[model samples]
Target chain A: MFCRRRNFVVLILFCYNNHRERFEKQLGEVAEVVMKAMELPELFAVFLKIGCLAFGGGYTVIALLQKETVEARGWLDNNELTDIMAISQTLPGIITVNAATMIGYRRQGLVGATLATAASILPTFILILVLTHMAWGFTDNPLVRKAFTGILLGVAALILNTLRKTGKTAVNTYADGLLALFTTVLLLGTGLNVALVILLAGGLGWVKNLYAEKRGAKKHGTD
Target chain B: MALINLFMVFMKIGALGFGGGYAMIPFLEAEAAAHGRVLLENYIKVIAMAQVVPGPFAVDSSAYIGFEAAGIPGALAATFAICLPSFAASVIISKFYAQFKTNTGIKALLDGVKPAVLGLLASAAYIIGVKPLYELSHSLASLTVLKAFLAIACGYFALTQKRVRIGTLAFLTVFALVGILFF
Candidate 1:
């Protein structure tokens, strides 16, 4: 009688365990779906805030993104951030946008890419729209006009400063400097289409590279 | 029609705009002129103000240009169009970046393209500065020209020189204030 009672108790316990396991599994799946739903919105909010604070230019945003994603959220580590930045630099786009797309793509996929890109741009889009409209209304004011003129002078300085900084990187050799000068004259003097000018420059660069490579090969062959 | 033109113009700018925001200035000016959407001086002024405002230079300029062209819709179109190339490029790179990163051909192309971009930027700086310098030349004694000169000199010194390290935004704000008070 004792053995039969013990078997009955064991059977009840086994049934309870099976039901509980099934219930927990279903609950976990639901939770996962919910988390997936929340992720895109969370991504949008984070990037929108980043967009608002991404001042100065694209390069500055790299630090901002690293701070938010690595330190605050722990979505990425330092090495990943560096890799993303390098890839962004290699591609032909704004680094910030490229980084955002890459991060989003890593996290979710193509939908995330589109969402993050839109979020990153939305704040600037809105801010510029509002400022431009207001500036239009205020253009009639002479004080505003004077301020704009002054800003123009400041901008010229700023551009030249940028030119100085960029020139350091772009113009390494004498040939590069000459090429830069050639580009300036070609654009300003001829008023050529900027796109065509860029293509011409790229073609020139490729041909130059090919020639150098062949010469190097010949030197190596002789050696 | 204007919206389509704005989109195409910016798309071209995006594909070609390699160096950074500043490097794209010449392209923006040239495209706007070619499209005949905005006045040259007005566009330049917008670019100037953009320096003071906080955001990516490309996005801010695109919005203003689009708005000037066709109101709110134009702004949206241009902004989206400008970002499209970057997005597409990133997508492809994200997939194949391991190999793409070390490609010699791309490295060589970028090598040649970068100097040309610098040249383009230099020409833009000259175009922007020529008028102010010309005015300064005529009136060495005028307060307005002096103020403009002071702004530029101080900005250049602060940025390029190591000792007087003021931030770009801070420096620009002070000059804007100076403009309101004196210019």
Candidate 2:
């Protein structure tokens, strides 16, 4: 009986090891697919060609995704696409990649998400990586410098535009505007940390909401 | 010393960066200041660079900070660290999201977070816009002032104007072209 129990323990250990190995192999495969998708021309070709061909940047990308995934491929519905966009923006990563991952996962599970993310990022990553390398080599090239200057100006414009749109959507009241203004002054004037600015803004927003609620209650009582 | 310090510091930042990239800025700034590796002005410049670059603004910004703090290795480490949490979170969350799709409490929590997210976004915009205008005013440059005014006007137009779809980009491109040519 003791010998039989020893044999049973050995069998259990063997099964556990097999299971662990299979799990590890699955994870390895996922990582490999993700990395390999980066170099796959067909995968990146779609994203790169679309990005290059498209006129606008951010919204254009959204439109392109709608066309490719919804209209052309019929991978997702309009509502699903919109939902993905909303969730993606709330998340920490790049919105485009986040959207791609969501759609991909919806279509083909974990492997799809990995491939889609790699594909979506491939174009920008390769372009920027190449540009960074080239910039280092051609540091003294006047044309390169001029082009960079132009790019910087373009970037500044893009940011300003983003701020405008974001402000319209985000700032709804006098209190919100004041909070924005206050946070802005603190950040730019004093060169306070961005993290601190965000925290303080969040805290102040909560406080303002409380104040407003209390004031409303008092007014209601008076009425 | 600087590079190694930056790698270690940003690794900590990445580990703690839960909310978003913007959420990581204060921690980054504190670490930089503590090390005396990066000056405040340069730190702001790094933020600006991150904003200008493509991809996720926060990740790019963190990478830029790491690079500025040390060099290439610093950039790699910082980027990796910053990206690690989101990557892990994504995998874990993806697994559970389907299960929680119909959970009312989760929905309510998400609703609560929405207004806060809006507030954060608003705060970011205001912070970014004010800096340049303040600097331009301090310099007392007419051209800078004009540019600042144009930015504000463009912002207003973009906000109020409904018919124009690309109003923001239009303002940006025009101002940028003008700045490049004249300023």
Candidate 3:
């Protein structure tokens, strides 16, 4: 019996040591990922790159990232990508970079986040830097001006398309449609502030929901 | 004094800029007016430039304006200042949201904000659209009517179309080439 008990204690110690070792290894991996991405200049360049190529704003970037990272590289799964997109939209900062960072962090921890963000932004930053330097000299160049005009028209089309798509998803009910129309009128007709409009809309939406809930509860109670 | 002023003004913008970049415009305009460092016309130019450039419109524009105002350091400072409040709020809200994921009140509040946010976005789009369209109409050129019709058609097409592909870029490039060669 004593021998058996001694063996059991040894077994417990062995299990504990093995568990600790695995935990340490996982932590080390996470740390390595985080540290790898902390380089500022390289990461900044990545951001610039993403900015340059990523047309149609937030959604476009999300889809591109998914194709490149999730499908091509197998860095993340669909569900995870969706979750990050949702969270990124809800948060502030550039949504694309935020999503990129979150996905990277999830995949390889910090280093991944940093590298991914840098990779995404680098193109835009460099392009902008070059453009800024040349803008004065090229400001009146007919070809450059024409090119920009065409790009602007394209951008307008893209934005209008996005607004329609976003509206379809966001404006589900009559109340939502009314709210959108009202907001549009208020903003366009008057110089009503955008922040105030959002706050008011958010507040109204909450109140409306609560009122509906209470009414439902009362009806149920009566029944 | 100027740098400190820049910091404070941007901090206010950061705090109040809900519903993302475009939503921050009026606040930015008001602040820019107050500072007088940049003229309203110049501010509008910066916004236009921002829209044409990539990434989040307001943030990138802020950086560009900062660079214009005071160079690289200024750019960094402005960017940091504008993002500070949103970053803090996001981090805090994220923590709170994790704990209260299913709380009805929280959910209701978020639902309430949706309409308002949409309103803000819609308003920005309309405002941006109006200026360009008006300018085009007033130009009295032969192509003015054509451009106006095209713009309206694009808006309608966008509303009806199920999908808008990047192929639009190829069309734009072709149009640009034609404009360069013919017009």
Candidate 4:
């Protein structure tokens, strides 16, 4: 463990040495941001970029933010990004909105949070209006139906791709894999309450942990 | 009364829209159907637009239904209501980020919740796909060779290619337009 810590420190120092100039630039900007009062326009512009470009929603926007904040803006590092994504997933609303609000509030407090939230959803709101109108206007056109059918087909594949990615993160063990499979069957084949399943599965996780802990303790005692 | 009803409907949708984004599509469709203000086919088109358009699908669908029900006020109200729960959640979450991140209990619970949500997401995809990709509206004979080819082609392209959503959307839009000119 001590060697591991030393190696990690060495790795960070090596990385910092490699990017010494960039690191200094980032530190100078960080100090500047800390000294200045947060501006609403800046906040709005940043979030507008995130909101508009996140066409695929969720992770696509998250990836965009990762690029902007980590690579370009130097606001967050890899560890911070992972922590934020983890927290956002636990939140009840759209992960994108949760992420925006969190990032805003972290930087500029309540006002920043408000502006970011507004900026993130504003493009979506306007786009929704335009789409609602287009749907109404094009209802008589059979071509619209055909195009939508094709879009639906594409959406299915897109969703499957997303599922595969999420599954990689969510399924870590045999137990997790079994739970995922069961939940899939329950949802696809039956009209069971999803809320109930979530609660029950969560309970199962706790129970599994407790059982494993007890077994490990027993083995240690025998040893 | 209509405005209040609209608010309540969307609040329910937001509450049940676990996993969020396109996962909410199935829930939004059911709620809109229950309201009986729009046909299923029309609602499907609206969902497709929400998917193709550059924004959050959950809000887009809510706004669509709200506009269908009452107009601008309905649209605004429904969007706000549906977003309220998550906004509230964000406030609490951002404040307690450190504590929540370190909590083993929450971690264990999320272990289960995440996979269950995964199932819901897959279920959403299955429900949406079955009608458009697999089923025949009129009869088995109505499922033409051309329709199957187009569906497979779109699905394969999207599934295989990177960043094909916008390209596929543009392609399908033109495809549909030219299709009518030919037929």
What is the clash tally of candidate 2?
1
Predicted candidate 1 versus true structure: per-residue lDDT over B26-114, tens digit per residue:
88887667656346666777776677566678888888888877888998898888889989988887788778778777778867787
Q: Pick the candidate with the highest DockQ.
A: 1
Per-residue alpha-carbon lDDT of model 4 for B99-178, expressed as tens digits? 87676665665555666667767776765655544445544345453554455456545555666445445644554453
Better of 3 and 4 by TM-score: 4
Candidate 2 regions exceeding 4 Å error are A1-57, A136-160, A167-182, A203-223, B1-73, B98-143, B151-160, B167-173
Q: List, residue by residue over A8-98, the lDDT tens digit for candidate 4.
A: 9999999999999999999999988866454567778888888788876676777888887788867668788887777777655677777
lDDT of 2 by residue, A74-143 (tens): 7779998887776665555445556666766666567766666656554444443445445455634555
**For model 3, how does the per-residue alpha-carbon lDDT over B1-183 read when each residue is reduced to its tens digit?**
656767766766666454556655556655555546445444554454454466666566556556666777766667667765655554444446566556667656655555655665555444343444455466535474366347535644754656754454465565456335533
Candidate 3, superposed: residue stretches over 4 Å from native: A1-53, A72-75, A104-126, A141-150, A213-223, B8-54, B89-97, B132-146, B155-160, B171-183
* Alpha-carbon deviation at B67 in model 2, angstroms: 4.7
Q: Give model 2's docking category.
A: incorrect
lDDT of 3 at A31: 90
Cα distance off (Å), candidate 3, residue B107? 2.9
- In model 1, residue pairs whose N, Cα or C atoms come closer than 3 Å (at least 3 residues apart or on different chains), thus clashing, are none
Cα-based lDDT at residue B17, candidate 3:
58
Docking tier of model 1: it is medium
Positional deviation of residue B93's Cα in model 2 after best superposition, in angstroms: 3.8
True contacts recovered per prediction: 0.63, 0.06, 0.33, 0.53
- Model 3 Cα lDDT, one tens digit per residue, A1-223: 9999999999988887879888788999999867654544444454455566675467667767676667775766888678767766655455665666665555545565556665655454444545566664664587855554444444445545555656665667788778777777776677665557656766777788778778987999999
Stretch of 10 with least lDDT, candidate 3 chain B: B124-133
